[model samples]
Target: MIPAAHAPTPARRLTVEQVLTGRLVQPLFQPIVDLTTGMVVGLEALARGPAGTVLEFPDRLFAAAIDAGCLGALDLLCSERSLECAIAATTPPPLLFTNAEPAVLDQPLSPHLIELVGGGLPFRQVVEFTERALSAVPGSMLRIAGQTQRWGNGLALDDVGVDPMSLAFLPLVEPEVIKLDMSLLRDPDGDHTRSVCAVVRAEADRTGALVVAEGIETPGDLDTARLLGAQWGQGWLFGRPAGIEQRHRYDASAADLLRPARPGFHERSERAYDCAVDAATPSVATRAEVVAALSRLRDVVAAHDTAVVVMSSADTGLPGVALSLAELASSGRPVIVLDQPATTEFVVAAIAPGRGCAVGLRTSNVLELVTVDDLPTVAVMARALLNRHR
Candidate 1:
């Protein structure tokens, strides 16, 4: 373990008069990166020490800040200092993420403070709001939300899956991003975490919020998060939190970080037609022939890291269609039947032909599969089909 000196100290009890002096404020930075690309995205501003004490964790420091009635001042100071430091560095400004208690946000900071930092630095920044603190001041949530929106800084709802109370604030705050805590992701099969993640994902989809799975520690954790639809990920698996002066350069070119967790289906969907044209034999109509076509198509999709699979089959009226596994199931086809030769045409028609339902498509699926190359054309085709049938 790192020495205790590196850890943050809790604030000594101080009078409200002492709080305004801002003497106790010191900001530390924890780097956030793109898990897929391993590129440093930005830093999370964490509070460090008050002159003397033995506390080292950010959580304790923040709690003491609240108790000392200096949380607002501390938050503002951290935001200002963190941004200034990032600008001085040669690295391109990544989005600076900071935590703001709802109580702090409810208090109005001089517009000049926001203007000063924003004017001097690149405006790519996100302020994460702690859900527990927000819940404590329920009546003022909307006001805080409006202020954050007006400040031109993006808002993120943090600690999403840990507390049940977070669900109540989702509609009221309408944050631009939602961060799922690592604890929730520990067990991929845990119903509570999965259910909460599903709800959070749905809210993100509805509001166009970016879902970030925070505190990722292992490859398994990363995989589970991606499978559950988190577009962005952060954790020890990516990088650990280093001190403010530390210049950490994340190598963004690592393919594992950039590659989608499920590449096979998405890649196949993108080049479904191409794979079909190249791999399928003309005279074959057996189950093995169809399975081989699917397998080859899966390989093509995997190469591109896509999530949807399209195949051409001779069974149904629609010879060519894309079918997501979910759609195939919902179409009332038995799993056995779906694996049978006759169901291939129906599956393709449902998914590829842009059938009546938008059942199986997901945003993560789109982001993983749709590249600059052929996304526009594929999108046009999908939309045309949706519109034509609607």
Candidate 2:
């Protein structure tokens, strides 16, 4: 006979049976912003227990669920809640990042869950994989790597730069985004951390993947992230987790969030001028013009050290440049050609074609100027110049 005061409290274990019965798990959103633009690019879905429950912490809840062999059910529930909440909410379209375990990737995603998410949400929805946790599962990591690409879902490698395992996975998986751990940015000078970050940046550039530096606590950390070429940044420096209503009310524009604390007179003037310019000239250049200019410039630069090609526009901006044969023969420095009139203080150096075409010896270093319709001309000139120089 046990006394009433000494009655035993049963162990509160969340089992698979209980989870399968549709125990609701609410998802909270934390914003991920572009540091340069200051716009909320996406929201990371965080799991939470139902209202008025003792189990509140997502970490604890998830761990318990895993131990009870209810991970699949828990994962499905979280996904369903996140998709439902996102579609039902009034917030603007943003990329939704959901945490996924490696094991879950091999299993077929629930049709109900897919239907909810696929109804309106775009495939830009990112599935963030925990590097350390994924490594532990057998054949799960490879399965996830294959499925993410096949499903056309964006893959994100989270907690990178801290685990050596991430180094191998990064090149193999080639995720859409790589999230650098906050610890690496905390003390950038710490043993090989800077080097590791450099390697990560290079890999990201090569793969055309965006870099997100996480755990930015101070302005210094933000600066470090920017220096390391992180396009997007997340941390306490931005905003913490808040309700959708609260976040919606808060302004997330670049001008609002990135306003200088104490701007100088010149800075203020520049901002005003920039705003006016942006408003006045919205469609500056067409994509075609931009691509043509870049292609011509790349070819010209490859040929000589001081080549020049002018655009056929009214303004006649410096559209292309390269090194001249004489300049290359003398010095290795590449020279840029300017189109605008020389100021009183500065003189524009001229490039004159050599006389008597001695074949390879004097194949006219000056390449053909590229026009809007002259992409082939630029390529031909580039090849000729390279052959002569070589």
Which candidate gets the maximum TM-score versus the true structure?
A: 2
For model 2, the superposed segments whose C-alpha errors exceed 4 Å read: 1-20, 118-123, 248-390
Model 2 over residues 186-291: C-alpha lDDT tens digits?
7777765676677677767666778888988788988988876788888777877655444633233422222122211111112111222232322234435444
lDDT (C-alpha, whole model) for all candidates:
0.50, 0.52
lDDT of 2 at 86: 74
lDDT of 1 by residue, 210-282 (tens): 7788878888887887877787778777666655567767443322222122112111223223222232222
Candidate 1 similarity to native, TM-score:
0.54
TM-score of each: 0.54, 0.57
List candidate 1 stretches off by more than 4 Å: 1-24, 50-56, 118-120, 248-390
Q: How many steric overlaps does candidate 1 have?
A: 19
Give the count of colliding residue pairs in each prediction.
19, 8
Which number leads on lDDT?
2
